[model samples]
Target: MVLNYPDGRLYSDDIPKKPAKQVRTTPPSKRTAQTQKKNNFANRGMRFEEAINESNAYYLSRNLAVIHKKPTPIQIVKVDYPRRSAAVIKEAYFKEASTTDYNGVYKGYYVDFEAKETKNKTSFPLKNFHQHQITHMNACRNQGGITFVLLWFSQLQRCFFMDSKTLDRHWQAQATAKKSIPLQVIEAESTEIFLGIAPRIPYLDALDHYIALKEQEHDN
Candidate 1:
């Protein structure tokens, strides 16, 4: 005669016992602790995206620059209608960004740039950038557009405005042993942006300095 339990499983003496999950008592490594500390620090202040949005609003209100963040495109694959007020999205996939994050006209010149943050204290890795972004920046520069990247070192709490040309040169040389741009190189080549009370990130001042340098280069 066969016997069955309440769960509809056959009651047998041969059933094996499941092993318990193992827990580690060792402390996290130095690198892991440092990364966790950086994450905590980031959580304390306003997010990078929020700060940029506020700065953009400030610029627009002052009639300085009309910049806007590009919305990411998404392909909706599945949807469910369970007799609710609205249809819920079940599954979706993100499409690749066509261009830089922020783009608009600033002082008769097209401005295009991408914003990125890194926790690395020594250098910014080239892997953060993509081929399509580089190609878009190249196209903008060819057309006399002001293209740059706002790089934030989260661990250092420092920000820099790097021109696309310099960025492109460094990106092209990533095949060598140096797969990242050193902080010293960025400090020397790029313009440092300071946080302000009103705009949060006063990037327009850096843009002005870059434009002045470009005008001087043209005059010489």
Candidate 2:
């Protein structure tokens, strides 16, 4: 199967698969449970996007906010009908560049943000972002919407909420400065978000803090 972007660039989804490990068919044991516990703890910071989605679901259930991940628009070009009820898409092309990862309304303020994860220990690569996304965020901000990004440092198990304006400044400076955002700069400018149980990525707390700071600036 083959997929392509609107600009005719090849999009490869062919990830190398790891060899399957031998499975042991056995009944439940105390050691198995302990191993499971250790595995759960090890995966505490895995699947950053899933954590954000679960957090959104938690917020929605409690009537705290209405946020959702934006689905990528893809145009199907080829399909294989293996059975009458099982049609498989074999090829597709992206309709266009996507704006952001998530957007919604929180407390009457329009909230728009992108979620990104990086494995780097010291900095986040700017190549993770695109020009279209930056332009869209700026447009939303200009219209009085709260625009930001949720950055997950997977290696450090840390997350930060950075305003789009701050991101834009760094993005534009890439011509002269380093092609990445340093950890020190992010720590200084962004609000840290601590992970939780129900809402894994407790991002709204950071949002509230950002709103308070904006209000203070307005009053001053």
Candidate 3:
């Protein structure tokens, strides 16, 4: 199967598998340690995303704010049917670039945000973001929608909720200034979210803080 971006660039997912090699026995203690390390490394990337999904489910079940991850639109170009009852997609392209990851309404305010995780300990690279996404967030904010991003620093085990405006400010200056947002800036400008057991990410608590800040701004 072949997949492509809307711009016709090839989206490569197929990696050639290396030829099987002879297995070697190792000491039991060493083997166990290696297995544990491998498992932890593999699951590290998925922890943040899975936590967000679980949190969303928790919110939905309690009749809280309605939110969901947006589905990407794909245009299938070809399909092969080797069997009467089985069909395989042969080629497809993204219909368009997605705006953001998740969106919904909360307390009469439209909420839109992107969730991203980085392994960096000191900074988050701006390359993780796209211009179209920033534009979309700006447009949402202009129309009185709640717009923010949830950033998870995997190495530090920290999460932050930063409003779109702050993101855009740094984004625009990237050409002349630093290319990444420093931890210091993030800690000062964004709201920190402590992970909880029920709703693992517990992002809504950060959202509540943003709403309060917005209200205060309006009041003043």
Q: How many times do residue backbones clash in model 1?
A: 0
| TM of each candidate vs. truth | 0.75, 0.77, 0.77
Q: Specify the poorest-scoring 10-residue window by lDDT in model 2.
A: 11-20
For residue 55, model 2's alpha carbon misses the true position, in angstroms, by 0.3
Q: Candidate 2 — which residues are off by over 4 angstroms?
A: 1-46, 79-90
User: Between candidates 1 and 3, which one is better according to lDDT?
Assistant: 3
Winning model by lDDT: 2
lDDT of 1 at 127: 76
Q: All models: lDDT? A: 0.78, 0.80, 0.79
Residue 140 accuracy (lDDT) in model 2: 99
Model 3, position 209, has a per-residue lDDT of 90
lDDT of 1 by residue, 1-220 (tens): 1223455432111111111123222354633554445334434323665688789999999999999977755567799987946999888644556688789989998999988777899899887788878899999999999999998898898999999999999998988758899999999999999888789999999999999999999999
List model 3 lDDT by residue over 1-220, tens digit each: 2344465332211111111132233644665554545434445545676788789999999989899977655678899999767898788655545488789988888999988777899998898788878999999999989999999899899999999999999999999999999999999999999989999999999999988988998999
Pairs that collide in candidate 3 are none
* Candidate 2 C-alpha lDDT tens digits along 1-220: 2344465332321111111132232434634555445344334423787788899999999999999987756678899998658888888655554578689999999999987777799998998788888999999999999999999898899999999999999999999998999999999999999999989989999999999999999999
